[model samples]
Target: MTNLKIALIGNPNVGKTSLFNALTGMNQRVGNYPGITVERKVGNFSLNNQTQATIIDLPGVYSINPTSTDEEVALQVFFDQTNKDYPDVVVVVAEAENLKRNLLLFLQIRDLGFPTLLCINMADQMQKKGISIDIPALEKKLNTKIVLTSTRQQEGIDQLKSEILALVNAPTTSPFDIKTINPEYFSAIEKNFPTIPPFKVWMALTQNFFSTEIPLDKIEHFRQNHSIDVKKIQHKEVVKRYQFINEVLKKTYTLDTTKETDVRMKLDRIFTHKIFGYVQFIIILGVIFGAVFELAKFPMDFIEGSFEDLSNWVLDTFPKGKLTDLIANGVLMGLSGVLMFVPQISILFLLIAILEDSGYMSRMVFLMDKIMRPFGLNGKSVIPLVSGTACAIPAIMAARNIENPKERFITMLITPFTTCSARIPIYIIIISVIIPQTYIAGFIPLQALVMVGMYAVGFVVAMLAGKLLSKLLKYKQESYFIIEMPTYKVPIFKNVLLTVYEKVLSYITNAGKIILALSIILWFLGSHGGENYNNAEEIVTQSEAAQTMDKEELEFAIAKYESENSYIGKIGQAIQPIFAPLGYDWKTSIGILTSFAARETFVGTLSTLYNLGDDFEEQETQIIERMKNEKRPDGTPVFGLATGLSLLMFYAFAMQCTSTIAITKKELNSWKWTAYQMFGMTIFAYIMALLVYQLVK
Candidate 1:
């Protein structure tokens, strides 16, 4: 089979991603370009039986002229000057209605020396918008194969594949004559190094590519030794390129000036209206949170029940010992806790995908940008801040697009303050335990209100932090914010499902690994103790109170005594006093400590701790039930409203995820900030938790 790499590159919102999705389907993987935070998407497809190729969806940019790190990566890879991720054939997707504007980028890639295909995407909408393109004239003028494709219409893909497969190395026509534009500039490059590709030399001189394919020191030297005014040369080049592009597009494209704006604009007016926008956004968010619980109820129940049954079966099937306990209360319990959240998470991912693919997400950025400006962040920070709701690690990574270092720093610092999905498991379980299930208007769930409140708590905290940080942290750099609102279209089902599948699977798999290992270790710690645990059976049976108890009652009492004396109990007792002010006993304290590995592990820890050795039966138990039944030494219910509310507040504000902290350290490249975030957030969490508990108690 022939192996090749095809890069899908174009301006943002040009349907490049849609085309890539059309070709690659579910065969794509998203990672990062080496040593950069920019997302990299690569996938596999076969043009023919023997013509298998990998397609990379490079970050979309307006031009090869680099400003942001994202654009730099695109240019570096296009010049075949990257360590890896160089494309064999560059497929530049352009909107048929806006070819003139899109051609600027296509022309840059064409000159940088690569076999290229120009795809006029959204062709189906062209005629309706009174747009027309002379395809043959364009192909001839640009000296490339131009394929008309409507990824939405599923048109022209097969022809595109045939063209790609039949292509051979071809020289670029009208490749910019650098000498004509600036003889001194060309002469300086040739004089220093004649062997290098002219464009590479031209690009290297104009701006630092900072690519791994070339030595960094050599680029720096070329930069330092040269007497080039970079901005001046870049300006001259842009003028010269546009001079050529204007001549080409004059005859090849036409648009009707009287074209009517589509329904998208009509909808955008109301949705993006100043007065209605925020109100509508909030209403949608309310529906989403409420629907998450409502839609996930059946699936969550099924998953919960299945795992519970499995745990019970494992206990009965295996020989009763530590191994059996480990598999039942540890592994099975942990896996169940992680997987149970899949239903809610899947809903969240699916809904988010719909909103993003439908192009409404950009409007959200537009709306929030106004609100974020006062908080020291620009509109661009909105993406990362919004993404924080999914998971903080990726959200922090998303902040790389914020061009201003100060703004990016502020974004990264406050992003974790947003409530993430990991907190949902924590929130929902607690809400179930403390909040009544009564409805307000016969349909709205009271528990769902608590869920929304939890999210609101995070958002408000993040906004306040942003406002404060904007005042405290000082850095000087011009921040840039520009976003394209793509023409709205029906979201592709396969793509939406693919996104949800990848995100949900990633969440469950990562959380499961940590929880499973912790559960086993915790079970071991909870099962064994010093002399107190060993003598529990004899001591409890010999007690004068046990003489009046029936056999079953006596057995349960002995089991309770053994559990309390276990090593895990001793550890919890050691830390119990510290959390006593927050209404947390030692057992709850242990749950908090275990959750440092991950917030979702809190529920799993409680499950493992409360799992029955004596009450092993076919019937299953819920975490809420076990927690509800828990008691203090004074025989008061352990998880009352005061304790549940305090715990909720703590998790809401605390930086509990070690994974998030480690990622923050790696992304920010500083352990000091990570340390500050961890300790600062935790201290705040403890104080608030204490306050809530004290007032409520």
Candidate 2:
């Protein structure tokens, strides 16, 4: 019974997450709040091994006034005591080096009358920046307990835990006067709802104009009767809060400007510059793609080789049967498809986490806001677009922060156009075959440049599509962009590595399950067949060409013939003509068709098809090498330059992932809009593939 739920809240980049990772370690799971797309992370840790506690890491927000739905969720918990997540105590995390800016949200939380403990994170950076805070004076002035902790150095953690455990009840009185923030509105609301807290009443009214929750019908009616100026009251409340925060800071906080000039400012000058910022961003992307290609190849090859050996061992150990084929060809092949690319995915996530934790990623938003505005997007859109490169599902979910429906919808529509992790495997498989592995300047790999070029193609197409959609879906809402530029520091290796591990694990576990199931189903379909398939041996042996072949070659021909007559091959052949103009044969057509459910299924499908009767192996051939050896009846490679490029173009444009479509439907709440996005991209993909194949051939 000795249990409590604590909510940790703060502005972004305040090392709040670092502290959470430190406190919870591996005891965390991510989920969503009920009836909302906003992500919620809950973790549990025992205090002193006596009292158990649940800590919810709420989404980061700048203030209580909710512009986006994520911020609304944050404020909703504080405003509505009836809500399930009303915390027992709040831990408001602030940046010690940037206490003044961090204090705004803290003050807002304190006003809500929750038992709040102020955690000044990044205390290790305070002395380096020559910033000093009178912790005792600040606690006394703000009427709260303060803990100066450093997640980096593991400082003040015990002190923070002891303080958090000891705290029991929230203070009865508000930190600042609620009536002082606009007497007319407060007095009016308080007069009617005398029993309810005035601060809660005010919040319910202000957010009611935006939120769908109907906590107080009286407050909604009362606000309508009074004809409240929502924006005007919001502005007045911010001004009043800052006035109080400034007075408190003047007494307890000081910064010496004489220290070494902030290197962050120097970096910002170029990093946020209009022209230079974009140039640097492109350079950084090229480096990331280059690292993904050249650096990950070693581990990727090892993984592929190891799996191939395992598959061969499974066949060698077990008598050939239906179960053995399913285990070796279906299950192991699916697992390999999932895991072989972990090195590349982990590398990309690691580099991205470093940029994000180091605070350089914010500059990207600033630089992009300029170009994004004309396309009906702002700095916030930069997040979903960039995250889309990793996966479109979460990226679309992240787009909830856009506030503008038109812009958010457009961002959602084009987000899938970005080359997701699924596409990375497909790209690697094809590019390694067609693009020569020559080094550029003997440093950068030529294949890496091609990878980056593919990403560039996706981004450019997404942006152009964004511009086109913006024009078609014009709206009158004005958008305001305000993002804080956190002080840059060396990225914490622990945090970065943890992020990479979690994300890469998620990719394998979540995507792997689907791949495994599909792989088995594909194997079954490829292995079993009707009269023609059953008669494949009879059909092949009767041919004069079969008599001249060697034993291994004859067996290979029989297996291929049987597979072509099997259920899956017949299905693929049915759609062959549709993709024939795009240079894809029946086998390639099967991969493309199966991939419509999930792009990662592309590799699994091919692996299952090519893995038939693959027991007699001496040197383990890679999936790419197998693909390279594939030929047409006329004695030409199937995956030649024109065909590979065409396939690449098709996948790059195609809206193949059904997970994205489901999320799009959920977010947009309209089948009409989702259909426009789904079928529209598919049509475009087909046309582009057709053009490229025809022109090149």
Candidate 3:
């Protein structure tokens, strides 16, 4: 079988992703490019019985000149011949209505002397918008084959695939001449680098970066020998390319303005309104979050109950031993903590995907820029901040889209302040226990209001942190913001599902690994300890309190006593004093510590600690009920209003999740900044929790 590699390239919002999905359909895998945080998407497909192809979806960019990391990644694949993702053929997807503007990138890629094919996408919209294209004439002018595709309608996809296969064997040639822009400069470049393409050499010189294939010393020598005006040359190059493009487009393309409608403009007017825009965005968020809670409750309960039953079954079916105990009480319990919240996470991703697909997310970014610019962020930062609500790991990675180093760093540092799904379990359990269940004004649930309040607090704190960091961090580059307003359309369900699937799967895999490891380690620590643990039964049985307790109560007391004397118990005891002022007892201290592995593990840790026993009845108990009944040495409740609120405040601001820390280090590529973020957030969290406890208590 013949194997081929294809690079799919396009501008943002050009239906490139939809085409990739339609071509590959569940055969794709997403990861990071070599050493960068920019996402890399690859998929495999079979073109014929004896031929197979691997397609790489390069980061979307406007032109070969790079302004952001995303564009740099895209440029690298084309420039670096030795790159693993370097393609045998390049396919540039272009929007049908915006062919002229899209061709700028297509032309640049074609001029690089690659066998390139232009796939004009969204062809279904051409007639509705009264746009007509002369495909044969355009293809002849551009010196490439053109395939009209509507990924939504599955039109012309087979033709696209066939053209791709044919292009693989086609001869490579440049359609545009670099010497046309500046003959003297190109002649000099060709003289210096005879073996290399002048256009590639020009790109390296103008972009101020070069691939491994180019000799850095030679390029540097040439630059020092010749006085080059990079900006002026870049402007000249753009003008030259567009001059050719406009002439070709005029002969081959036509759009009847009289046949077009102003619906898009009218919709943009309302959606982008200074006053109404913000109001609509807020309402949309409210509905989405409200749906997240309401839609997830039934599935969450089912998952919770199912896990409980499985744990009990493991206890009953397996011989009573350490392994069985670990599986039942440790792994299963911890997995349940995160798995149960999957419904809520999935729902949130589903809604966010729909918003993004429908083009409303861009408007939100545009609207929020006015608010965020006062801080250190731009419209791009809105994406990472909004994404942070789902998971901080990817949220931080999403900050790669922000071109400004200062704003990107600020976005990474402050994004964790937004409430993540990991914190959802923590928030829900705590709110349920402390906040009233009744509704306000006989309509709005007070619990829901508090939940919204928590989200608001995170956003407000993130903004304040951004403002502070903007002043603290020093960078001289001026920030610029430009966003595309994609024509709003019904979200493609396949695309939405794929996005939701990938994100949710990532969330589960990351959280599951940490939770599973910590659960077992926590169970072992809580299961066995020093001499005190071994003598727990004797100590509890002989106590005065045991004298009044029944058999079941006696068993529970002994189990509790043993857990407190266990290794984890001793560790908790050592940390108890530090958190005592914040109203967290030794047991709750254990939960807080385990939560560093994952915030959701707080519930699991408490479950394992409070329910460590051999009694069958005790194994069926719920963590919330046990927590409600818990009391300190003085007979006061451990989870009172003040303590619950304190815990909520701490988790809200604390940098607890290790996954987030690792990704932050990877994205920022600085241990110093990572350490600063970790300790800074943690200390602030402690101070806030302490104050809240003291004031509320």
- lDDT agreement with native, every candidate: 0.76, 0.78, 0.83
lDDT of 1 by residue, 333-393 (tens): 7677667767776876688678878888778778878878887888778766665776676
Name the weakest run of 10 consecutive residues (lDDT summed) in model 3.
612-621
What tens-digit string does per-residue lDDT give for candidate 2 at 132-172?
99989998888889999999899998898888887666464
Please tell me which predicted candidate would have the highest lDDT against the true structure. Answer: 3
What global local distance difference test value does model 3 have?
Answer: 0.83
Q: Which structure among the candidates has the greatest TM-score?
A: 3
* Whole-structure CA lDDT of model 1: 0.76
| Model 2 / residue 356 / CA error / Å | 1.9
By the TM-score metric, which is better: model 1 or model 3?
Answer: 3
Candidate 1 vs. true structure, TM-score: 0.82
Error of 3 at 294 (Å): 2.0
Native-to-model Cα distance after best TM-score fit, residue 217 in candidate 1, in Å: 6.2
